[model samples]
Target: MSTAIRPHLSKIVLAPMEGVIDAAMRARLTKLGGYSRCVTEFIRVSDVLLPKRVFMRLCPELAEGGLTASGVPVYVQLLGSNPEALAINAQRAAALGARGVDLNFGCPAKTVNKSMGGSVLLQEPDRVAAIVAGVRDAMPADIPLTVKIRIGYHDDQLLEQIVAGIWSAGASELAIHARTKFDGYKPPAYWATVQDVVHDRARQLYINGEIWTVADSYKAIQQSGCEHLMLGRGALAAPDLANRIANDAVDQPPMAWELLVGEIEEQFLQHDCNSPRHIGNRTKQWLAYLKRHYPEALQLFARLRTLRDVQSIASQFTAHRQQDLSI
Candidate 1:
C-alpha cells in the first residue's frame, strides 16, 4: 500500500448505499463535516468493461479528481461475481480518477444475492479470494484496494475464513458489516461477533452497520474494538453524524427543517439530469431517511409524496420555510 492510502484506513468513511448516497448526497454530507472518505453506490459489473459514462453517472466525483467539493475522497465501489470483469472495471475507474476501489461482498439485497453478487459470495471463500486478488493485481499498487463483507452468509461459521481469505488475497483493508446475510438489516448489529474475528488480525478492519448516533459509535468502537467505522443509513438519517463523531460531542444542534429543505433543494439542483420525477423521488427518498431523526420530516414527506413535479416540491419548501420562520 502506498503511504497515501494507509492514512485513509484510519478515517471515518461513508458506506456505499445503493440508490442513496449518490454524488449529490455525498457532497451534502461531506460538507457538513467529519467524513474522511465516502464510497460511491456500487457499480454492478457482471460482464464487459463498463463505459466511462456509467462510472461518471454513478460517481460524478470521478470527473473532479474523485473528491467531493469538500475535499473528501470518494472511492468507487464495484459489486459482481466475475473476477476478470471486476478487475477491468476497477482499472477503468482508477484511470478515470477514482481515489480507491471497494469490493462489495456484504450487500444482502435479495436481487443482488440471487444474481450471485454481494453477500452470496460469502458462501464461496475461494471465489471471494479470487475476486479480491484479481482487482488488487489489476489496480495500481499505489491505489488502495479494500473489501467489504458481512460476518457470514447464513451464520457466523465462515467469518474467520472470509477475513483470512481477504487478508491473504492482498486487500489493504477489510470492513465487516456486523451481521450475517440471514440477519438482514433488522436486529441490532452483532458488534461482538466482529470484535471476536478482528481481535486476532487487527490489520485495518473497519466495523460498519447500525452505528446511528455518537453513543452508538462509542459502543461499537468499544465492543468491536475497531477504531474505523463506516456509516450507512445512520448517516443518511442524520447528515451531521460523522461530524459529531469526529468532534466527540454528545449532540450537535438540530438542523432546522428549513435548512434541511435547502440541502435537499441543493441536491435537486445539482442533479443535471432531465427527469423531474427522478429528482422528486430522490428528494423523497432522502426525506424518508430523515424521518427517523426528525418528526417534521415525516410531515414534510407526507405533504410532498404525491407531487411529481420537482418545482412544486421546491415551492412547498419555500412555503414551509416561511411558515417555520414565522413560528
Candidate 2:
C-alpha cells in the first residue's frame, strides 16, 4: 500500500480468461479497486439461443444488476460464428440485465475453432461484420456491444480489415489481443503493429496481451498507441495489477504473499466455483499463475497440489496461516 501514485491515462479492463476468472474472482479483484469493468467468460452460442440458466451459470452478477459486489459493471461475453444464433443469445443476456455485451472472436482453442467459433471466424471478415451487426441490431441500442479479437487466425493479414469491419458494424468498443490465433500465449505481443491500424476515435479501442506488470503496461501503451488495456493472465499473476497501473504506482509492494495466501484459502474454502469435485481446483490453478509473481505460491502449491478433499486443503490452510503467529 505504498503512497506512490503516478496517475495512469486510460481504462484498465479485467480480461475474460474462460475458466480462470469467474464471478467469485471478479468480486474479489473488483472489490480491491481500479478496474473500470469486467467481462465474463464467453458464453458459447450456437444454432439455438441458449437457455436462461446458461447465462445465469456463467454470469451470476446479472442478477445483481450486472455489477460485481464492488459495483464494477460486468459485460456478458458471447462466442460463436453464427450471426443469428449469437444475436438471439446476446439479446437474451441483455434481457437478463447484462450491462453490456462482448463478442469473442479471439479464443484459440482447437475445439472452439473446429466448431467455427472463436478465432476461426477471423478467416471470414464478412461474417465477422455480419455477426457484430446482427448482435448489435438484436440488442437495444443503449446496451453497449464490444468485440474482442486477435490480430488474425493464422496471420495478421486481415487485421486491418477485421478491425475496420468491427467498427463499421457498430461495435462500441474493440479489444485487440495483439497476437494471431497461431501465436497462442507466446511472448512478444506485437503492440507496435496495432499502432499502424486505423482506429475509430469515437469508439474505444483496448490493447491486450502479455501485459504482466506496470512497466509492461506503459510499454504496451507507448508501442500500440492505444490508451486502454485489457489484462488477462497478467492480472491473475498480480491481482492488484489494475490498481497499480491506474494509480501509476509500481513503488507499492504487491499484496503480501501471506496475505494473498490467506485470501486464496478463504476463496478456496468457499467452494463456489464450477462444481463440487472441483473444490480446490481453482486455487491450485490460480497458484500456477501466482507463482509467477510470488514465490510463496510455489511452496504452498507443492503442499496442496495433490489434495482435492476439502479437509486436506483446509488443513493446509491452517498450517499456512499459523506462520503469522510467529511473526
Candidate 3:
C-alpha cells in the first residue's frame, strides 16, 4: 500500500449509513473532530451508468470540495451486484473528485439484501472478488479502495472465502461489521470474529456495529486488536464520540440545542432544502438521538413531527430549540 493509504489503517472512520449519515450529519460529526475519514451513504448502482447528477445527490460533499465543512475527507461508497456497473460508478465518483471509494457488503437492510447486494454478497466470495477487481482496476491507485463486510450471511460457513476474496480483489482495507445478515442490529456483534480476521489477514481492519459509548469503543479496540473503528449508531447517539476516543477533548462540548440548530440550518441552506416535511424528517430522526443527550429538545421534535408544512415545522423547531437553550 502507498503512504497515502497506510495512515487510514490507524485512524477511526465513520461508517456510511444509508439514510442516517447525510452530509449534514457528517458535517456535524466531523466538527466534533476525531474521524480520520467519513464515508458518504451508499450510492445504489443500476445496470445503466449513473448520471453525474445522481452521484452528486448521493454525495453532495463532492461538489463542496470533497470534504465536509470540518475538513474531513469523505469517501463515496457504492452498492450493487454487477461488477461493471459498480466499477463504472466507482470510477465516475473518483473522477468527479472523491477522496476514495468504498464497497458496501455489510448493509443488512432487506431491501438491499433481496437484490443480491450488501451482506448477501458475502455468500459469493468469487463474485465479490470480481466486483472489487473491476473497481480497483478502474480507480486510481493512490485513491484507497476499501470493502466492508459482515462475518457471514447467516453463519460463518464461508468466512474464510469472503476474506480471501476481498484481499485477492485488491481491497487495501477491510471493515468487518462483526455479525451476520440475519443478526440485524441486535447485540453481541461478535468482535472476536473480526479479531480472528485481523490475526489472519494482512489487510487493515476496522471494527463496526453497536459501539455506543467510549467504554464500548475501548473494549472493541482492545478485543478486536484493531486500532481503527468505524462508528455507526454510537457516534449518532453521542456526537462527541470520535473526539472522546481520539483523546482530543478541546472541542468536546455538549450537544446543545444551538449547535443542533446551527447544523440543521447549515444543511438546509446548503442543500437548498425547501420541503419542510423532508427537512423535518431528517431533523426529527436526528432529534430522536439528540433528545437522549438533551431531553428538553423532545417537545420541539414532537411538535415539529406533527406539522406538515416546512415553515410551521421550522418555526416550531426554532421555538423549541430557543426554549431549551433558555432553560
lDDT of 2 at 91: 89
Per-prediction TM-score? 0.92, 0.94, 0.87
Candidate 2 per-residue lDDT, tens place, 168-255, comes to 8999898999999999999989999887774545228789999998878888887887879899998899998888888886776677
Clashing residue pairs in candidate 1 (N, C-alpha, C atoms within 3 angstroms): none
Superposing every Cα of model 2 onto the true structure, what RMSD results? 2.5
Query: Once superposed on the true structure, which residue ranges of model 1 sit more than 4 Å away at CA?
Result: 1-10, 200-203, 324-327
lDDT tens digits, residues 19-73, model 1? Answer: 8778888888999998988998999988999999999999999878999999999
Clashing pairs in 3: 276-310
Q: Which stretches of candidate 3 lie over 4 Å from their true place?
A: 1-10, 200-203, 248-273, 276-279, 317-325
Q: What is the lDDT of candidate 1?
A: 0.84
* C-alpha RMSD for every candidate: 5.1, 2.5, 5.2
Instruction: Report lDDT (Cα) of residue 96, candidate 3.
Output: 93
Between candidates 1 and 2, the one scoring higher on lDDT is 2
Error of 1 at 279 (Å): 4.2
Candidates arranged by lDDT, highest first: 2, 1, 3
Ranked by TM-score, the better of candidates 2 and 3 is 2
